[model samples]
Target: MKFAPSVGVKFHEDGSVRRFPGNTFICHVDPSLDLINELAWAQEQLKAMKCGFKFSYLPIESMHMTVFEGVCDQIRLAEKWTSNLALDVPLSETTDYFAKAVSNLGAHQGFEMVYDYVHNCQIGGSAIRIKPANEETKQALAHCREELRKATGISMPDFDDYHFHITLSYRVIELEEHEKAELKATTDRIAERISQSFGILKHRAVEFCTFDDMFEFKPMLTLA
Candidate 1:
């Protein structure tokens, strides 16, 4: 993991917003190389659509499993803070080197790298789903459901739970009938292949970590 300093507003489940100094790091486990190839194919499909906006795709290998945020008095201090933390380097040293290179650029510039990690991983698409019955898991899930109810002001049915997925591309906010049909067809073909690939592989856990301007990951007590 590599870390960088940042400043941003964080929205918590409690309905309060706070400003913080923070850093973000990427954690992945034996990510399938085929996934990168699939993303490239998706990017090509997106490019041909020419949805009329700057459509940038994140590199597949740089996906992040967690994002940390908190407040720092200044960017340099934050960077210095993160530099002192230890990291569990992934099997790919190239990714670690890239993380180091990006970190040296300072806080504001680092957000783009963070964005790339989140964007490529489709973290935003994750949806809430019911966990198997276990006291700890059940309690956590219940709390999350309560937060959603409060945030949306709607009492959603429990049976409606489903897996969450992140959006890979956003070309047109609203699409014409033909465009929607084309998109559906293309996505279905892509999804079929991805589903098969994932089905054959063992799943790994994704961790959540946060950092503050102090340039340290709160959970790991290290830079990355």
Candidate 2:
């Protein structure tokens, strides 16, 4: 949508927030029509299921694949890292690699990186858990992570955990057991089909984002 420029927090040497940035890209996700379509489909399904859920579908503007967040200073370092990274890699590919690398890095390492790079910086977001996948899936994720490390000169800690969600929906209203089961079944089927389709596609990119709250996004950055 709209990209804004704003100053973020300034950090001290110890990685603490000197000040919070008033403007920042709080969420960064792929901005692709295909992803929009997928989300639209998922939303329709979610609505039709009518499991008494009160949460609204996240708008595209609010969704993002986070790069980093925190007090002003830490984010500056991450921004520098990202800018330097942009020089050596394509935006689409870099976004994909970041997602896949974090996923492949496992939960512990993934959490650490998120904490160190994004979370610790005061970037507000949730760290996902990797789901169980076959050997091929694991290998693919590992390869992506390795490539990111080599390119960024950032070594993630020992995190051998995986999560299978893309941080799509949240702030869910309470649901009954029956509703939960029904919704789970429907979402599971959708996830399975998506996983299969993505598995067949050798390369994919994280190019768009959606969010529960739109106002949180600030100082948006674009690749082109």
Predicted structure with the largest lDDT when compared to the true one: 2
CA RMSD per model (angstroms): 15.3, 13.0
lDDT of 2 by residue, 1-224 (tens): 11112212232232222333222222243455354455456556666776524333445555443332211222334434443344444344444444443443332211111101101001221222223245654564555445544543444233233233334443234455676577667667656545433321121232222112223444322211
Error of 1 at 57 (Å): 3.7
lDDT of each: 0.33, 0.37
Clash count, one per candidate: 20, 36
The C-alpha stretches of model 2 lying farther than 4 A from their native spots are: 1-27, 69-165, 199-216, 220-224
Candidate 1, residues 1-224: lDDT per residue as tens digits? 11111112232322122344433332332356455565556556655653312233333443333321211223333232323232332213322333444333222101111011122222121111112234544454344434333322233233245322323442313345665566555555655555444322221332223444211233322222
